[model samples]
Target: MKRITVSLLLFLFLVTCSQSDIRHNQDLEDTTYSIVEDKNESVIRLSSLTTFDWEKAFLFSPYSPQEMIEEQLDVDFKDPSDLDMRDDIYLLVFLNKGKVVQYAEIERQDADFSIEGNLTPSNDGINIERY
Candidate 1:
């Protein structure tokens, strides 16, 4: 019985851990896939602008951004239950209105995606002050 219990626990641990690796090809994910906006418009898509595959490399690292989600805050933090635990966070870096800014790797299908994640000159980035 003890062996069975230990085996079950170990299996559960491994199962929980493996999900972090799924869909986590960080090179392909991090490498920028340029989306041309137009000439003189000077807009670019930041969805795939990372050169580092922080997701896979940092999945188990203590410094991972997902660590930021587990803590409680006065401000609204996206419920991880609502988000794909497998979803990796990336920086959406681009230039807009002559200022460079970084956005959270947000997908339209993400439950966490909302008007709040949007970066705008008017926001002055006060919204993203937290981790």
Candidate 2:
């Protein structure tokens, strides 16, 4: 009787541990995002920004450029007509709660490029930085 009880407790502990690990993995997968180069155009495509719960959070709350790239925008750069298309070009894009878009070009080194910043909304709009 004692051995049987011990074995049952051990099994339960293992099951609990495995369940926790699975939940952790699911959360990691939900938050993962990526950027891929568009082969047809001279542009990069940002992907996986529309996962369910995170999208709702992004649409309602103030987030960073990194968070936006990892959670919200789903734009494709088909025509580089208005863009400078240089390797050194950096852009700050603002998207309002209404989904309106605005942008500004900044002179910065290509090596200094990153997709991280706090993108709080103001009277102007929801602001984000892009490299």
Candidate 3:
């Protein structure tokens, strides 16, 4: 009877461990796929822009220095009347014809920025088809 009980306990432990491992792996795969999907979408949208440049595309906080932003885009930060200085992160993009686009709700960690699961065409960027 003791032998049978020990074997049963061991089997249960092994089963539980395997199940946990499966769940962990599944979570990792999902996260990886989500990152990849975001990256691919960003590439597609950026490629559609007629005057997109890698050097000019960057992340900035609302509190970032005005000089930094103005220098990067080579445009004056005129503080447009329609612009609201919301406390949030943004992606500054420069386009042809002296157009500038700002994508909001960007995620920032120290100096790193991530758009994963945050991009929406209507809110974050223009429709690729129209651009």
Question: Once superposed on the true structure, which residue ranges of model 3 sit more than 4 Å away at CA?
Answer: 1-45, 48-56, 61-63, 78-90, 109-111, 114-131
lDDT per residue (tens digit) for residues 1-131 in model 3: 99999999998887555333211123322432344345334323433332222223334545666666667557544332112354433434433334344322332222233443423332233221111
In model 1, the worst 10-residue window by lDDT is 54-63
- What are the per-model C-alpha RMSD values against the true structure? 14.0, 15.8, 20.1
Per residue, candidate 2 scores C-alpha lDDT tens digits across 1-61 of 9999999999888755533321112322222212212122222212222222211112222
What lDDT is reached at residue 58 by model 3?
A: 38
TM-score winner between candidates 2 and 3: 3
Query: What 10-residue stretch in candidate 3 is worst by lDDT?
Result: 122-131
Give me the candidate number with maximum TM-score: 3
Relative to the true structure, candidate 3 reaches a TM of 0.32
lDDT of 1 at 112: 24
Candidate 1, 101-121: lDDT as tens digits: 222343312112112334333
Each model's C-alpha lDDT? 0.31, 0.32, 0.39
What C-alpha lDDT, on a 0 to 100 scale, does residue 115 get in candidate 2?
Answer: 35
Clashes of each: 0, 0, 0
